[model samples]
Target: MPRFPRLTAAATAALALGLLAAAPATSDEPLVTEARVSAHFDLAAGQTPENIALDGDGSADLTFALARQVAHVTADGATSIRATLPAVAHPATPIVTSAAVTGIARAHDGTLYVNYATGTSATGVWRLPPDGGAPEQIAALPADGLPNGLALDEARGMLYVADSVRGTVWRVPRAGGTAAVWATGAALAPLPAPPAYGFGANGIKLRRDAVWVSNTDRGTLLRIPVLQDGSAGPAETRANGLDGVDDFAFPGHGRSVLAALNSGSRVVLVRADGTVTTVLTEADGLSHPTAVAVRGRTVYVPSAALSTQRDPNLVLARLRHFISRG
Candidate 1:
């Protein structure tokens, strides 16, 4: 969801209030619980949950940069969407820029990594103050770009950024150092981009061990073998049901993977052995479901109509607990 933030005043910010009333933006805070998003909560109209990452202590929290909000919900759910979250614990800073938030990554300190569309000649990655500070342009993405996805290798303290246009992944050194090419998808002589369709590697997942990439245009879940020299292995296609795949995550449990088929208009799950099944149907309300993320029990999916108000952000309430069970 891209925003045309009024003027250069920067995008607006929203935070989950009430219980989060006095929560400090400091790195350490019990603001989020360890339990993934669980059942029982209501959703605000037009709030689109974008991506997921662990807070300082590993609590499942989702960043909804587009809605200019962040919501705490389950990574999987069983009942209705409302049944997933107990309540909206916190509303995040409306740190959304004019560009719709194509992707979001979380820092160990709970800071958010934001990606915006290249409107006109603008393209780059922005860092939302973990607590309360101004966002800084860390990298200026290539112009005429697709959604550049990102993942933080916590152990290595490196940020892996995927650029579909250039068909390359860059490794940004820790603590805001220069970025270098870590892995190149299209650059790989093995998995070259298709002539007709580009392999738009948009979403990235840095697990406890390796890295997983959602090849949007390729319709495959790529398992990138981590390397000591940083040269990624030839990606293995973990699943094939992805149709216009976007972003996905392991939902904290690591038994299954949830993916968004943007053009396909649905959200699907792939089990351990690459078993694919439909979880959230378009019938329930998925209009061009774009990016997705999971907390503890909740999985947030933002259905975008491409700047159309008719199809505002469609929130999939409780998700974690339910998807986990199924």
Candidate 2:
């Protein structure tokens, strides 16, 4: 996660007025309508949602980063805590400054997988069985590294984790065992720290036989092919100039995606050809949106409010359609 300074009262007021909108969308940009906050979270209680996983019935599983809890939100906006990660005695996490639960993925069997970065030995991937037992650490990741993104390949019984600090992707067995570095390269490494704290691979998703990752420091989206033998192929840039991009989701069965620009407080639709379209912004109730998930035409975006410290929430929007430019 990238750290951002809090907005001044004047700046916040301007943003609320839509005077400081993120790069305005062109006529050719994708149209997102009926954008509204579906669920409001408590900023003081640390209910800021960092990432989301959608269930079959329109419910959502969310990782409340600062709260260190995994919660459920129903289609009608009802929210409840599903599980809470164990608290650390002396918290000392890298970059973000606190122990947190980040990315999440739900399995076909109703199992839930999530990443926790505690800067302690307990930092790793955890599993919450559908039977409602206590969540347990399944794989151990580097205590110094920030595991921010997680994706499950259910058919292959594998889990892919994006380590923001280590600049690597680790592969862990679905049954809980030793983890292995699946891929690493310059494309995944964080930018040299004159800025002091920068994240490398922040978000990840498995789709269309490839693993897509977002590099926050590099401000780019990358795609690494899954070779026939299940090895990672060369990494290629899909889109760039997405400064502050944290997490993203494919809205349709297409190459285009809606990405969360955390620092920019906006969500942009990146087309197949890499053309970027500003769709949702701070005016639409996004308080530094951290991740996106879509089910049919319904889009779910969770805001962490790391900078805003205001209304951290889950916003729902309708993906109307992309405007075709002739």
Best by TM-score: 2
Index of the highest-lDDT prediction: 2
- Model 2, C-alpha of 178: deviation from truth (Å): 0.7
Q: What TM-score does structure 1 among the candidates reach?
A: 0.65
User: Residue 198 in candidate 1 has what lDDT?
Assistant: 51
lDDT values for all models? 0.53, 0.85
Q: Quick one: how many clashes does candidate 1 have?
A: 49
What's the lDDT for residue 207 in model 2?
A: 80
lDDT tens per residue, model 1, 33-96:
2322232222333344445444443244444434434444433432222111112123221222
Q: Looking at model 1, which ten-residue stretch has the lowest summed lDDT? A: 11-20
Please list the residue runs of candidate 2 whose C-alpha ends up more than 4 Å from where it truly belongs after superposition.
2-30, 322-326
Candidate 2 per-residue lDDT, tens place, 11-59, comes to: 4332211112233356765579899898999877778788899999999
